[model samples]
Target: MNKTKNIAVLGGDARYLEMVKNMSKSDDIHIELVGFDQLNQGFTGAKQIDLDDLELSKLDAVILPIPGTDGLGYIETVFSDKNLQVTKEWFKKLSKHCLVFSGIANDYLINSVNEAGLSLIPLMERNDVAIYNSIPTVEGTIMIAIQNTDFTIHSSNVIVLGLGRVGMSVASKFAGLGADVHVGSRSKEDIARATEMGVTAFHMNELSAYTSQCNILINTVPALVVTNDVIKTMQSNALIIDLASKPGGTDFDYAEKRGIKALHSLGLPGIVAPKTAGEILGTVVEQIMYEQDLGEE
Candidate 1:
């Protein structure tokens, strides 16, 4: 009872191209490439389809780009001839039992999918994929800290916000490089876990007092975790790198006004390291496809 899956890959960049290559190489998949004509001429054997004229009712699954939508139901397509947009109405049409997968899907996109009665899954939220992908994310964060700052990571006071996969990895990497790493987390077990790793750990409650002395500040918390008031304690030249999704933790306006360097770092995978990033994505997509086939029985 092994069912073959037909994937409609829409409007992705090199990552999508890599995914298609990986999928095609796999025996379980039959991917229908939609909007490949608009891409840089390299994906061999991928059939092109007019994305604007795509029929949602035709595919077993739809794969979208990471950060699926910017809370507007608009999908950014790098593989399309023209600007391709996926509206809320399109989600409605796609609601007919198609499993939608993306790296990171937002609230509006989720709402649209739910409204359309379709299943939407974000790969970044998938535990197995997310944790593994965090390896690149952590490596990227380390690379940025190395590139952006004049000071070496060794002996630098580094404050990493939120003890999630990225935060923990960042903290561990910095610590391994002989930096004094401090992790900001909310949960007791997370704090304990950070302490166990020989790093200074604090709950969000204690973030204010110890945050200012750091030479590097990396925020992984996906919200407005760093405010203007907190920014006051930070040194003028301190580098604040926010890795959150949208409206990130750092107050960019305030940081700029105060002469502090604040950066909202996004798409690290594609930018800092695309090949490794593509492999990370390819691994996950295969798992999903595997699970998908199992579910068909």
Candidate 2:
């Protein structure tokens, strides 16, 4: 009989629940699950471990949530009074043979893992995977806009900041529905590509001048590209949907003071399309594991 690989799951939302379900289907894996007991009530054959009882050192792999274990070394779990924390120091107690994986990597986690000589894999850092993730993000953005707005997308003027994967996907998605899309990008190739796709593209030159004409503004750029000057130019009813990370691009204070609606919609794919996101992570993690085994051989 083949020995099943032991994997440990920490805290997360519904996306994590779906991930566990997908992993359960793999014949070569046996999960020592934590933080999801009630969710797996009907699922048989998997062992449940208490928050403080299980020995992490014995596991072959430890899986963390997307945006993984923040700077404070805290684990954002849904269970255990929502107070149970998992840190890199705690991770240091794990066996040397064990591997660690998360959706993202931060400085403190990187330092601690390196000090402990542990391998840490970031699943979302892969552009190939992020590109696949962007499809759901685009769809979710459209859903949010439709739900919030009274007007139709047809003939609406939409401005998209940044032409990266999510931006490209979003621009194309809005354009597909007959909305006039204008993309803000620094790259000539991307601008040319946007033009070829039948959407108006703009370089950094005079971006604020165009801001007032937009009915909807979507920002995919992670930086603070949308300053007070830009926000001041927006129409009173124009919606600002920032898809960037936390503390996103736009000036929320200004938006609120002006009574313009500004929303920071982070982790759209996970919230709106969790099953697809989980499958993407599972597939990538499987590939990483397979490649690592091959390297060992």
Candidate 3:
């Protein structure tokens, strides 16, 4: 008889609730839920248990939420009252063949996983996952733009920084909304792609020249590309929506002092569409496990 694979899901947001549900569908996968005591929903075959109660040596796979862990090694759990720390010592207990998955990686997580000699996969690094995630992110971006701006997206001059997966989608969606979209990027190929998409493309070096006319500025770049100089050039009433990870690209303090509206919106997938995001994650996780030949006799 084939042995059931043991999967441990660590702390996470509402999206993880759906992830637990999706993973529970497979009879061969036995899932353990951690840091979810506050959740009232129940998973059919999953067991809710504390981190200390988990038999770490029996874990076949471990799932950490997006954002992974903080620099101090504490995982994010909106539903938990206690801090869940997955330290290097904790990782050492995992089975040698155990797979670890997270939405993104941090230095602390990378170091810990490396010390334990474990395989760590950051799903957000996958092209398919990133492309799929862009859907909800763009939707949330549009929603925020509409709510924050006084004028319609139609005919508004929108500047999008970066041409990554999310940036490309954001630019295309704004253009589709009839906004005069301008994409700023450091890559010549990305600029060419933006032009082909029927949007104005310009080098990021010339960002200041365009900022004065921008009604809405969206940043996908993780770096501090949207500096005080860039913000100073923008209109007083302009809206800055930064879609990068935490501590976004824009100069928020400067923007606030300048009376410009700036927002750092993170985890839009979980916030705007938890079910869809969770399903996307579930599909990728299952595919990965299959490729690894896991859960088979």
Candidate 4:
């Protein structure tokens, strides 16, 4: 038997606008847009409603924005001025087997979902989403480096910290542009992968050693790898693009104190290419829904 799935999209940017459009194409999926009252564009097959108007007991799922929460329950809303917040109490009201989707999850969200006995899917943890997001991330990194530096990327010393999905793309793209690309990593397999990609690979412990000669230092590691000690060794004219999550990995305070241009670039895909980023998320969400039988054809 076919069943209708009710999903609420709560507090998000332009990407969620496109996601709603994509998800609503399935007639069996009914979407409610909350905290988007100020958005001028009308969502087809979706209704815009205030969060207070939602009947939590009837909802089958909830979709949160990529940035999700700020380690608190406050959601990011660009379209409205309303203060939108969600907590474990709200999650507990949802129907059984309800699914919650977000680009990423913080401690508060993780705890809330666990306590509610609901499933929380952090979509960014998926390999496909990470790799897809890497394209826009690399482009944005190059753009930032170019904008901040007086020298061209070609033949410049570029050191990429980490060899994760995004890090690998950043390294290869820069290497293809004739830059002297060097990748730092703790994983032996990642180091070998960087070497196989024809870029210089070094241990992360040797990061400070390369900073002095590096013209553009890109850190993708989500930890405090670029501390004051590391930034102190970097050239004053160098550019630092930290692609890690919130608060980033770079010591922005010390980098500024040293006069090095450091930028903590987050949500690069949404910033550089919103439609594509949104569609990638939409595709994945649709796939997950179909696989889980959350909705029927």
Candidate 5:
């Protein structure tokens, strides 16, 4: 029995290409590639076509890039020259049963999908996906720290904000590299975990108190945790790596005014390890599709 399902893969970076390749290997998937005409190679079971050519009514699922869309709903099509907009009308065209899968979506995508009565799946929200993603994110953060700092990570005062998945990984890696790692978080359990891991732990309230001696300040929190007050307390030569999403945790304008080198790095997995990231997403998507099929049964 050929239990193939139709999927429309819309604009994205190189990761999408790897994902398509992975999914196409399975005899159960039939892929339609949109906004990817610029790519040289072709997939075995995939058809490259324009957005207009995609029959939303026939699609079992619509796969979008990790970033989903720009704030204005423009899908990120790095491989194509076309400006592909994911409007509400596009969602309206999709079959009511069709699943829309993407990474963290913007408010526009969420509202539009809701209005269109389509199911939107935010893949990054899954614990398996986020934890897997933290690997490449932390690696990229360490890469940035190594490239930007004059001194080695060894014995340096490193403060990692947020005790989330990415933060935990960042703090662990720095500590492994012989850095004096200090984890800042609000949760007492998280702080205790940091201490159990043999690293210093402090509440976020004490962030400013400890910032003055920080050589490498890595922020995984997606809030304005690194404000002007925190920046002012840091050494002028300290390096700040903000791994949160756009408009990151750090106040970039204030950091610059104070002559601090603060970098807001978004989409690290796509940048540093696209193939691995793609494989992770592809695995998760495959699982979701199988689950959906079972639900229908």
Candidate 6:
């Protein structure tokens, strides 16, 4: 006889709801959901309950929404009107052996989880998850580019900064759309790969030289790669889409001053395709739980 794994899912958006629905289909898993009453749909094997009713000690794993916690520790829940806080005190209630999983963790979350001596897994850091996530991100980026730009993608000169998973996807998609794509990277290997993909590749140092000709500039690096000098070189009508996290990699103030349209598009997976994004996350979580069960055996 095997014991069912008990998991607590905390505040999240529509993707989380979809994830809960998918995960609840498994009879081996019992799900406890918090901050999701406003949603009309319900999971088959999941119970939506107040946070106070949750038994932290009984949880085998704690699943947080992709955004994890805001810097202030408040969890983002779109379905619930009430605010939900996953503070250090809440963490303290969890069993020390419980595993905590989320997309990205903030400084406060990292410190708190470390202090509590619990294992924390950042799903976004996983290569498999990040690579799969790039698909939706690239689709969303293309949608944004089309909506914001006056010209078609057919002949636009697009510059993609960073040759990471997301960057590569963006470059390939634009090129497939008949755009003249240029990829910028710090790595020689990445540059070579980009060139092999039939796109022009340049070292990061040459960003300013290429920015002037760019009709669309997409940044995947989470650093200050697109500085004031780089922004200064861009055309006035150029669209700057910073796909990086909060604060992004672009000089927003300078781009605004130059009359360029700059957008910081974060969490594209959840925004553009919630069902697919949720399945991606739910599949990973299910795999993790299966491995954990095998290990226990």
Best by lDDT: 3
> Model 5 shows how many backbone clashes?
0
- Mind giving the per-residue lDDT tens digits that candidate 3 earns over 1-297? 145779999998888888889989888889999999898889887989999999999988999988899998899888889889998999999988889999899899999999999999999899999999999999999999999989999999999999999999999999999999999999999999999999999999999999999999999999999999999998999999999987889889999999999999998998999999999998888788877774543
TM-scores for all candidates?
0.88, 0.92, 0.93, 0.92, 0.95, 0.94
Q: Quantify all predictions' global Cα lDDT against the true fold.
A: 0.79, 0.81, 0.92, 0.88, 0.91, 0.90
Clashing pairs in 3: none
* Off by more than 4 A, model 3: 1-3, 294-297
Model 4 misplaced stretches (Cα beyond 4 Å): 70-72, 294-297
The list of candidate 1 runs beyond 4 A from truth reads 40-45, 52-58, 69-74, 86-97, 106-108
lDDT of 6 by residue, 154-258 (tens): 999999999999999999999999999999999999999999999999999989999888999999999999999999988899999999987799989988999
lDDT of 2 at 146: 94
Cα error of candidate 4 at position 292, Å: 0.6
Per-residue CA lDDT of model 1 for 1-297, tens digit only, reads 166566677767777777777667766566776656756555443566776666677666888887686766666766564656678887777637578888777778888888888888787787777677677778888888888889998999999998887888888888999999999889899999999999998888777798678799999998887898888888887889999878788889998998988889887777766777777777777776577667766
Model 6 ranges off by over 4 Å: 70-72
Residue 151, candidate 5: Cα error in Å is 1.0
Better of 3 and 6 by TM-score: 6
Ranking by TM-score: 5, 6, 3, 4, 2, 1
TM-score of structure candidate 3: 0.93
Relative to the true structure, candidate 4 reaches a TM of 0.92
Q: What is the TM-score of candidate 5?
A: 0.95
Model 6: worst 10 consecutive residues (lDDT sum): 1-10
Q: How many pairs of residues collide in each model?
A: 0, 0, 0, 0, 0, 0
Query: In order, what is each prediction's RMSD in angstroms?
Result: 2.6, 2.2, 2.1, 2.2, 1.7, 1.7
